[model samples]
Target: MPPADGPSAPPGGDEVDRIVAAWRRVAPDLDVEPLEVLSRVARLAHHLDRLRRGAFAAHELETWEFDVLAALRRAGGTHELSPGQLVVQTLVTSGTMTNRVDRLERRGLVQRRPAPDDGRSVLVRLTPAGATVVDAALADLVRAEHRMLAVLPAGERRALAALLRRVTAPFETTARG
Candidate 1:
């Protein structure tokens, strides 16, 4: 019988289960706990990426474009960030950020203006059109995510997030270091 709170494992079923069993049979000495969790995480990320791409596309925005626009949108009321700052937020290379800014500028979604305080520096500002589209895309994305997470109860969801954060913290810390 399945547990009332979570998914049930049917006899000799579930893809993850099958994979784990196969690995155990092939390499019984190896610890596969990380694979069991991380594999699912990777798969989930792939699906989420597709879902997010679809949601953003509905607003006539590609994922990369949305990432830049949303980063600017979240940068307080000014809705602008230096390309260097954007590179940090979006985790793209300097050249990539420059290209993104250029594309967005051409699309009338963003503009490059001389920084007020730093005469030599330029800031990428989200235009009204960019803000409108990004905002709509964000709303749609959130709705879709909420629907996907609806499978878990509030308490379980919180616990899952905490657990995942704990598992992921080391990687984030290492990257920062």
Candidate 2:
């Protein structure tokens, strides 16, 4: 649950009264019902941001670091992936991905190697240390997500995920197309 003063709730009776008055006079014909759902999305995103910060902080990892590490982790054992592949999976600019890889390499988390099939390209693989860090961080992250989901009943959580997938399906299909 969010704090009482969190944006998920209306500001106050007075503020709501003023908004109702303004809407009644200024846009009487416009349906404001969508605002309720959109506002909750905005508020929930804000809350989730805080949760993510705290969760990542526990493993001494920033959100961006986790983004990269998690991508490699998902690639399977040895956590090997090309820089280009990481950029695609991470949805980051090539330069940004290069910088991230450099930082991770410097921290002894990952290494770059000549690509087996391509002389002009390199593959980034997680070192043993990197694998350990990613494993620990992933465990912590899963625990945090589990805690968050605990607020909802199991059935409701599944329903919410299904609904969100339905909402997002068109965008995913368009992007793929």
Best by lDDT: 1
Model 2 lowest lDDT segment of ten: 1-10
lDDT (Cα, 0-100) at 27 in candidate 1: 84
lDDT of 1 by residue, 10-122 (tens): 49666776677667667889999887788888889998999999999898889999999999999978899999989988888999999989999999999999999999999
What RMSD, rounded to one decimal, does every model reach? Answer: 5.1, 5.3
- What's the lDDT for all of these models? 0.89, 0.80
The TM-score obtained by model 2 is: 0.82
lDDT of 2 by residue, 81-142 (tens): 99988987888899999999999999998899999899999999988887787788788878
RMSD of 1: 5.1
Clashes of each: 0, 0
TM-score for each candidate, following the candidate numbering: 0.90, 0.82
The whole-model C-alpha lDDT of candidate 2 against the native structure comes to: 0.80
